[model samples]
Target: MTALGELQRLRASRGGPPRKRENKAAFLFLLPWFAGLLLITAGPIAVSLVLGFTDYNLIQPPEFNGLDNFNRMLSDERLHSALRVTFTYVLVSVPLQLACALGLALLLDRGLRGLSFYRSAFYLPSLLGSSVAIAVLWQQIFGAEGMVNQVLGLIGVQGRGWISDPSTALSTLIVLNVWTFGAPMVIFLAGLRQIPVMYYEAAAVDGANRWTQFRKITVPLLSPIIFFNLVLQVIHAFQSFTQAFVVSGGSGGPSDSTLFYTLYLYQRGFNNFDMGYASALAWLLLVIIAGFTAVNFWAAKRWVFYDD
Candidate 1:
């Protein structure tokens, strides 16, 4: 029976038409992703784009008002203030974060004792940075009678509320942004380790000092990694939310100094019940970030280098 079945199967295989090489496995794997892309991402994006031109506040039916939202945003005082604060935060925080990250990475890359322990310790903050608990901790640390003021009291230097004083509130958030540089520090460390020892040795043989080697070889080779970190950090800084959200008590107060763009969108959509305006704001932010990323890539041609 087995022999007869095998003979029949062989005959069937020989007589059958050539099978189509369908990519069933690849199609199956992509099915769930495609569904998610359509439902979660693409669907909402389309809805938001439509809402950007309407006057829907989630309670009333949407009424088409082409260009009105954009024009209103142009004349909006609160949006301008939010934009100023957001830009200030991005400009100050991103570069300082990258600089601090690079510095720490260089320090850690020097074959320190218990390097793993130090690495984990440094990375702990990045993990906790977005947590409400950490934001609350930051609030306490920068509050009127918080630890910073206590330290200041010991030194007899008058201390205002770090999170309440408009002048210091934004700067405190910038410091918070810089303090979470550990993730970038780890990336920089990995990039540093990828540098071949031969390059340094060859430079040394030619009488190149450490600074000279770093300038000529280390920096140039690491330029790609630096550029990657810079772009990522800038985007993250621009979209910062939790720290300011918690510190400002969800009101973006202290005279709106910490009113980040995202926070403002939340204020409009949720608090003020203006979903259409918030959607428009969100689209504008998306465009701003896209423009910034595009400009960075354009400028990167001059500064960012690739190894041959």
Candidate 2:
């Protein structure tokens, strides 16, 4: 008999093929994941979408009021200020942070001694950057009688309250964001190691300088990594909440200068008890993030390179 006919005969001799039993077991194993998806993630998202169209305080039943929250956003001066602050933070900090990461990665890639220690030390900031403790520490460092002013005092210069100043409060948060460069630095270091040394050697033999080799070989090969970091950092910067919230004391205060979109959403939802408006704001932030990510992907085609 042919192999297929023999197999069919064996299966018929048995009750049936064992594939059904295996499939059942696999489904059983995946049940918890499916349950969590429906209960934890998907359920909240569905409810939030419904809540966005209604006006419901925590105390009252939802009253359907389509587009009012959105319309209010158009004329909300504070919301506009928050948008501007957020955009500025993303634009200014992401590039600076990436630059710092790339510089440090380059330094570390040169076969430095105590490489592990240095890498760990540098990466620690990223782990702690968003923590409330770090934010509070940052506040102390920039306060009127803080370390910054103390140092300036020794230098015969005056220093003001950096975090408390409306003009500079946002800048302090931006500096905090930039300080969390360790994560990207590690990624860049990995990307640097992946580059084949032969290409650099070939350029060197051709009398190319370090800058030339970097411009022609390193950049082209590393563009993909750079783009990856850029997209991730931009998204991360937009979603940043803890640093701003903790530093601003959950008020986004000093004339709303440090008001992040997420902070405003939190104020509306929890502090003000305006759940419906907060849901709308949450969806809006999602749209904004999605739009920026889409733009990054679209723009990446012109800059990002690959081996193939």
lDDT of 1 by residue, 1-308 (tens): 22323543475575568777668987898999989988999888888989999998777899999999999998998899899999999988899989988888888886789889989988888888888998899899888999999999999998988888888899988888888989998989988988998999999999999899989998998887888888788888888999889999998888899999999999999998787888899899989998988888778879877664
Against the true structure, candidate 1 reaches a TM-score of 0.91
* Model 1 spans with C-alpha error above 4 angstroms: 1-22
- List the pairs of residues colliding in candidate 1: none
Clash count list over all predictions: 0, 0
Clashes, model 1:
0
Stretches of candidate 2 exceeding 4 Å from the true structure: 1-23
lDDT of 2 by residue, 1-308 (tens): 22323543576685656543577788799999889989998887888888998999978799999989889899989889889999999999999999999989988986789999999999999999999999999999999999989999999999999988999999888899999999999999988998988999999999999999889998888887898889889999999999888888889988999999888888999998999988988888988998998898788779877565
TM-scores for every candidate against the unseen true structure:
0.91, 0.90
lDDT of the candidates, in the order given: 0.87, 0.89
